[model samples]
Target: MKAIFFILFAVIAGITAMAITTEQTTIEPLLTEEITTETITEEPTTFETMPIVGDEYCTWGPSYWCHNKTTAAECDATTYCTNYVWSENTKGL
Candidate 1:
């Protein structure tokens, strides 16, 4: 009878330990902050407002304000070039 009681006590303690050791779970609060972003735009450029490469550039002798000349012309018509001749007969004036 004593042996049977000891076994019963051991079984109850094991069951109680198992019940207390079961996995536990907890609830956590969620982040509620708002996020935002911004986009940027750039302006377009106009080629007409910019200076042409050889339009008024010239090269060779006394400079003259030359206008549109043939691409085959010897010198640029812009003020940038040096040593060029000016004539009413210049191609493309």
Candidate 2:
């Protein structure tokens, strides 16, 4: 009778240990998510005009045009017109 009781107690202890280990086991995500990123770049637009003579001017500051080179230079110096260009002949040929 003592031997039978020992066997039953061992079985119960083994089952309890198995249940505790199962509960403590870590669970992994079934579906792992991968993240990806992309970068896009665009070209700047260009302004074109016909050539002229003696009517020099400068293009600067958000599509603004200056008829004087000095003013254009000032705008450039102030960083207001970083991409200034000189155009000729406002009065046309």
lDDT string for model 1 (1-93, tens) is: 999999999999999887666532121222333333432244556565776655554432233344344422445433322235444454345
lDDT of 2 by residue, 1-93 (tens): 999999999999999999888765633332344434532244567889866753443433434434344564544532333334333343211
Q: Which ten residues in a row have the lowest lDDT in candidate 2?
A: 84-93
* Candidate 2: residue 17 lDDT (0-100): 97
Please give the lDDT score at residue 10 for candidate 1.
100
Model 2 alpha-carbon miss at residue 84, Å: 99
Q: State the local distance difference test value for candidate 2.
A: 0.52
Q: By summed lDDT, which 10 consecutive residues of candidate 1 come out lowest?
A: 23-32
Cα lDDT of all candidates, in order? 0.48, 0.52
